[model samples]
Target chain A: MQLSNRLIKWLISGPPLVFLLIFFVAPSLIMIVTSFRLPGEFGGLAPLTIFSEHTSIDSGLTLETYQFFLSDWIYLEIFLKSFFIATLTTIICIAMAYPLALLIANSPRKFRNLMIMLVVLPFASNFLIRVYAWMIILGPESTLSHVINHILGVLGLEPVTLLFSPFAVLIGMVYVHLPFMILPLYTNLEKHDPILLDAAQDLGANRWQQFWCVTWPLSLPGIFSGSALVFIPVLGMFAIPDILGGTGDIMIGNLIKDQFLGTRDWPFGSTLSIMLTIAVLGATVFFTWLARSVMRSP
Target chain B: MKEIADIPEKTMRHSSPLLRLIAMLVYAFLYIPLCIVIVFSFNDSKLNAEWVGFTLHWYQTLWHDHEMLLAVRNSLFIACCASTSATILGTMAGLAIHRYKLKVLPILAFTPLAMPEILLGVSLLLFYLQVLNLTLGLLSIILAHTTFCIGFVAIIVRARLQGMDESIFEAARDLGATPWQAFYHVTLPLIKPAIIAGALMSFTLSIDDFVITFFTKGIGEPILPIQIYTMIKVAVTPEVNAISTLLMLLTLTLIILASRFDSSMLRDPSR
Candidate 1:
């Protein structure tokens, strides 16, 4: 794909480019401008109008807005919360996915696709809906807890609180993002030759060692992609915390949304957003580098 | 990486049960909530967990709710419209870039996909709210959706387009056909799977979209997931369960139907 000058090609590409340029890029540029807004003395956002509001143009352009986020302990805590949730979600996803992926790959063809579909179908809805599903299912006296406790009561232990805790958030995070993990692992694991497994067992290696030495390493490409896919979104998820965590489990995403949509603090929100984006990009780069090094191993 | 492979019978003594336990527990973790949602949708009571008796009242309630119908209508309309537009544009972009050797367009085209859904939503919100001074509504949502939908279409279409044997198009052109005729006679037929696949992928992504729509939707009721999010703020109701159950089924049905359309032989109308 070399860059070439062609009238017809440009014309063909013109519509989508123009549409995105006007709507997507333009609005984004405008938001960046808005993100720089300084708050007025009355705690209202100083509007960024070029016309009437421009009479006091000097009133705009302040670093105080961004500084607010840099100083706020609550915002920083929420940012760390987002990271923790995403990391926990990634670990759980890999732990579960590696096994399920292996089983599905070894299963018969018809069931394999069906299993994959079952895993991914849950993802086909707005991700928020699945979070809502968890809220209902995880609440104290919730059906799931009730059932589990009813069984545990056979041993006389009390019912437990699984909802509205970090544990609940973790469950929702892992549940919703597991498919991202499974699909990648399955893609890599499926390419695996079964004869390798037969050969390993013939060599007298146990199931655990075989996985540690071979399957895990072979599946790293998938593991990397899937983990990144899960972790990146989970890092900024607002809805899961809002519903399942209720008042307590607020994450950095909620804080950013609060800044722009709630508090009208554009600068602080933008700063936080920039930070979050950088964190994701950095982590993805690190993992990709790790994967590359593993790939080049002798 | 390794030469050795198969497992020994003696090794199974310690680990097989542990793996089975882990798999069972994880699957339970995944589906038990879904099962509860299905069950409560049939509950008689207002409170979700409190099942007074089996009742279809929630389904009745959802059907009668005008706001729910409007949300459904708007969501379906936007999803359908956006995917159709994205599919055509994506197919063109795929063909143009692959066939005509376009440069820099590749990276610029997909940069939109790299942006998080939240940022995309907020940026579009600002565009519609401040710059354009347009009210939040279905139109804005569709516009927002199609932006991301383009990436999906481009990926699938490019995949299909690349899979074709380039010689077929060459032969058609060499046989005295015009570029349009060569494309129509050879290339179009070849890449139809990717086009169809991309279109379906685009549609599902749009249909299931929440992040972008959350920012762009201006008016009442919003989409189903947004409504569900708000409902979670109140109390979890059997009615919400019923709605989710219906949506889950609808999504599954659409997927099943889309899978049936994966025929590679689109040009041969006889096939």
Candidate 2:
């Protein structure tokens, strides 16, 4: 019986473990190794051995990609810009999602499920469709642009193009990522005990003070998680920037994508991916630490 | 329930007018774009700028487009294949994590869920081309989709398992039933709803996937999302809106069905 049970354990776990190992683990390891190697004559990695080539060129693993990334300021600038955009997007999502989440949380229990479903429904649409919606809204010929530009024209100001700009990119990011923010915040806020708020109010605390002293502090975990979801995805997002962003609005995602698909520099692409992985993991750790410390301090 | 019922009506009406207004605006922000897409799909205009008149011209164009049809076929095929495999493997992974003290399986199952979609896309791209030396097409795409989708299914199934009454399983064990027999007669039936939900979720995810599909797809086949991407990047037309509306309807149906099968599963925070 014990032997059969053990066999059953392997039966249940082995397939997925093997599948993920082959597809997920092996590929990730390959990406790390590819980052160290040199670019090939065409696109992929260069030959590891000198015997494959007539000329004796430095081939097998090297730190050249990392060195190149360090030597150039543009790559660093792109990283900074991606971070800035992700930060701004996360902040905006918080501001927009907080009140909405609060409302859903505070709603009658029967309606809460329906409300949360509504929040998630838009996300059922394709990601590109969500981004493309912004393209239509922000296009110069669209009503939004025409209205805004008309108002500006009346005020003797130059008409600003809305379709392919940093502003448009930000809107697309916020639009697509808003649900991620709302869900986590709603989940967190829904669990808050109403009795605590009542006690705070009875103690002569105003609404704002009650929120600050009670609700806000209680909801920090949700906020942190929501921020991570929005920030991390935005950091690595390429589609929004690719479709809606102007030439000047390139984020790290675009730079990495360009290396793989456009420029065909596999090694460089792998390097950018590694950097992005580090950035994402680093941000996750820092925010977790910050959340811990902040929670501990109070 | 009693505590919530005991909360004063005054506190229950905590929504200020200002808060209501902001929340309404946020809801609009969530919905207006999608509303416009569905609305514009029927628009009788090339530019999608205005509601000139109601027409199904773009839908007709989409229906007749062989490339679009082919892409739809490929996406359906991939979604079906990928979701099936993911459902099987993920159910096992979920059951294992719930039943055992395994460490690596849990991380392996869930890490893909947290990582960016593009990372999975690129890594698999390199793996297929360089390591497997496999031709990139529907097969590569199916593998890639399955790899990422296992996490989603596992999460759903695990949540379902966590909610289940364990005493029943123990009772079955004590009844002199063999391990496989107990699993077949007991656990399988109990987690069926979760398995269905996971399958539907995987289907929607696989069909809607663009980034990973973009990397793994070869030049030969026209996958739906990639085709839509090309059309959008190259030009803006009502046809794209038409396709978007239809695709939205498809996924919306799948999501609604998944929620119906296991309502609590969809709302799981750990998802």
Off by over 4 Å in 1: A1-5, A40-59, A147-160, A195-204, B1-21, B50-52, B100-104, B108-115, B263-271
lDDT of 1 at A210: 79
User: Top DockQ: which candidate number?
Assistant: 2
Docking quality (DockQ) of candidate 1:
0.35
C-alpha lDDT values of all predictions: 0.72, 0.91
lDDT per residue as tens, model 2, A1-298: 7887788899989999999999999999999988998999888878787557656665477999999999999999999999999999999999999999999889888888899988888988899899999989999899999999999999999999998899999999999988889999989999888878889989999988998999998899888988998999999999999999999999988998999999899989999999999999998997788678777986
Lowest summed lDDT across 10 adjacent residues in model 2 chain B is found at: B1-10
Error of 2 at A71 (Å): 0.5
TM-score of 1: 0.87
Model 2, B193-254: lDDT tens digits are 99999999999999999989989999989999999999999988899999999999899999
| Local accuracy of candidate 1 as per-residue lDDT tens digits, A51-140 | 545466565666775677778787778778788878889998898887777776655555666666666655665566678777776677
Clashing pairs in 2: none
Model 2's DockQ?
A: 0.73
DockQ of each: 0.35, 0.73
